[model samples]
Target: MQKKLVCNTLKVQWRTAKLLIFAQNLTMGTIMAKESYSAVLITQGEHRFYQLAMPSDVLSSCTFVSTRDEDPDKGFQRLLDKKRAKEIATYIDSGHGTIPTSIILSAQEICGLEYDSRNKTISFEVLSGSFLILDGQHRVFGFKLAETKIRVPVIIYDGLSRRDESRLFIDINSKQRGVPSELLLDIKKQADYENSEEQLFREVFDKMNGDPNSPLFGRLSPSKRVKSKISRVTFNAALKSIYPALTSRTPGEIQEILSEYLASVRDQIIRNGGDENILLNSITFRAIVSFFIHAARRVKDRFGPEYTIDNFDVVLGPLFDNIQIAKLSGTSQSKILDYLEKHFKGEFQL
Candidate 1:
């Protein structure tokens, strides 16, 4: 039988944690070439791992999905000084800092991996758009920009939910004494004072952030810190979108209704493989929730005193049935206004 494979298999170890790593013998310094490789894919409780090597050949293809504070000028991970990367590169080229001491990285959706674990090595092609750099954006991009190639190690956590990826990033960088992580934590606290709906929004955001079943879990920036993709500003804005409708609703009541709605949207997004895109943004979330509170009054009145998923979905089903996230993402302001006014024609009033 001709053994079918994509890339070669190799052995890897880390103090009793052994991995049958899949690797390639692609020529060094040819990072830009369209090359293919293989990986050892492992599945663990809603998470995937693709243990592989780090080189320009691989890093060049990987995307950087950063949780860094994005500045329009400096962009994500603004603290990543090119001078620092240059220093590292110079040290490497000088043959002194040959081994990267504590470089840590995490990635999502390794196209270079298989879905499940069967104890068999899987082959993966190293191609552009194969992965995302959840952490270590500088070192990875630094090496790529440095005009030199060095083989570093990487932990490619394939098929990771955004929350898990964020957690891993926090774990790696925080333990490394990353100043940014500490600052983010500090900022997380100060965010509450900066806003009017901070109390209600924080409660809702915290529940969603902590709940594993929640789609927004791990994806919300609670500290206004450099964690997760979504920000507290977005969350606060979402509340403000529904602020007028929230006259009598407590935070817990709001949490229950939003949780169910988010779970549905999240599942739909994941099912469609739309997780990578900025699909669940402030506009869509705010608009949908606003529409729900505006339109679900019949259900609320009939059900009496409390809101429920059934009540939300009665209106949500008809409204959201017409709403496709991929199609509606980044929708224009006029369209959003039109959408809100359309279904809310006969909504229950506060």
Candidate 2:
């Protein structure tokens, strides 16, 4: 059966050297997709699997969703504000000044492809149950509610495996906002998340709050909402100090060690008196993280790689045990930092 050309919005382009050399057989390495959905696919990259797909159709056939680092298993996140979505829908349906922005997606396969020599077009078929949105959740949601026919533009990365998808999710989520969240929850899930070292810090930050056994669970405040008073920015800033030495550890490994340290030492510090959440104090958390790095770096310099996580508690445990908060109530955070810093440098080994 001939797949229908619903509109002329799709323009075929290729980014592959091999495909360009064999222009006559452009679809040679293409994956076969569904018979119903075909697009003008052009390879324009170092890899054969990456292509530009212009699907000249609305989003009615597709589903829209968001991911959360806090919990991917939790139900999909809130869609665009209904009022905003409706406003965008009106503009889209009206078809005035509608130069559409692209929504990005990643999918597992391309079932089939065939180059149309006569019409100079390329038709593609995407395998079913394989579409995941990496960016532009709102634009897709807006188009879905449009009243009139509108062919939404899409950039779909084809032939991506699950691992590839997760990494791509992190790359896109780190620099972009109001998008994907599962891959790097600590930062990607938060609206104010940043890139570079902060990305690593955010991942570890989120893990401490979201991981099941985390000592900081329900402690850090996410930018999207204020669940706790612990400043995500301040804590993340403090984390950057230790970021340089974190090269050899994965986020999980670091999270475990840090959380364990907190659990072991919480009893010694006077964060609160009774029935009060003293952990919400920004200065205390920041001071603790900063001093840990100061002490850990010293340990690393002396012990070299011999300082294993196996004995983290053996060495760093009692160091925190010396904390004696003179007064938890009305105590300035600066005093806490000074005290922690003194203790951190004073208690070098034990």
Candidate 3:
């Protein structure tokens, strides 16, 4: 069998070589094999083979059908516009001759269409197999509208899986300009595998940085862009370094503390005519929080876990009161925090 195969390959190559030589000499016409010839050659062995081919003119014999009869509650799938659909149909009709077969195949795969024999037409139902819309959905939809006969390339899978389909859909739509941040956040919440606070923070960070729809998507904040400047890490480290007497707290407890600190800062900013620059640009808020945490730890060590900064009017109360005065001095945020820490530590009395 091997010898026979080798002989057959050599014969085919010799024939091809002879044809090339003849074509070179003639420089007029070339020999081409039809689908029948290809089919015959492919099925030469005992193995059964199926060859399906659609002519250029007969390509658009398939019709599209909606899988959902009722209104889709998901709100992910969008309805096609009559004007845009007509434009697409026109483009498909005019550009069919110019567009490459590869692009057409790509369109078919994205739109999810397949050929059916019993129906004697191509249908989206036949292409109901699981496939992702990699790129160019609008163009494909346009083609569907324009041409009566259109050919598209498709990948067929056993069943349509929602998880797999949603992932692909997200990836495709994610590239569109001006995607809303709320939509991305909702998607992240739904798609997130980890439910822990730390995991949630990490996931939010990752998604915000990576997804196009996130407010912090590609833009670099001073803290986010520079590794050494991330306020959260720097503030946490400063607290730990200054107050070695402090112990670790649970994620929930830490979150509550941070939330309260942020709320206080926001309240102060709002009272000051809502100066966004002062609120966001100043590192004082972060530094002050770190100092407060250190002060709280010192109080905790001297007293107990219940001894919070809220109970210390002399320390905590005056620090919040003095923030505006310190900020007005044009002093460095770190310096102001350090001064406050020193005062609380008894180097000087406030």
Candidate maximizing lDDT:
2
TM-score of each: 0.38, 0.38, 0.29
lDDT of candidates 1 onward, in order:
0.56, 0.57, 0.43
Q: What's the ranking of the predictions by lDDT, best on top?
A: 2, 1, 3
Q: Give the residue spans of candidate 1 off by over 4 A.
A: 1-196, 224-228, 264-279, 323-327, 343-350
Candidate 3 on 13-127: residue-level lDDT in tens?
A: 9999998898875553232221111111123233222233433232222223222223364324455456775676676677543334321122224334444445434333222
lDDT for residue 245 in candidate 3, whole number 0-100: 33
TM-score of 2: 0.38
Q: By lDDT, is 2 or 3 better?
A: 2
Total backbone clashes of model 3? Answer: 5
TM-score of candidate 3 against the unseen true structure = 0.29
Per-residue alpha-carbon lDDT of model 1 for 1-350, expressed as tens digits? 22333222212234223321221223432233333334556566666665655566467655554435663432333356777777766766665556554234443344445533455444444645566565566666567666667777665665556566557666666676534442343365565433445566667777777888766776776544443356666667667767777657787777777776666545545555566334356566665555555555756666774555555555555555444445446556446645545644635233
> Residue 22 lDDT in model 3?
82
Give the Å error, residue 129, model 3.
31
Please write out the lDDT profile of model 2 over residues 1-350, one tens digit for every residue.
Answer: 12434332222233355456566444553334343333445565532332333433434344345456434754234444677767777877776737366677765344344445455554445433345666666666666667665555666666766666666667766776653232344445464546667667777877887887776787666554354556567667667766777767988878886775566445444322232355556665666666666556655676664444434455555555664453332356556666666676685334
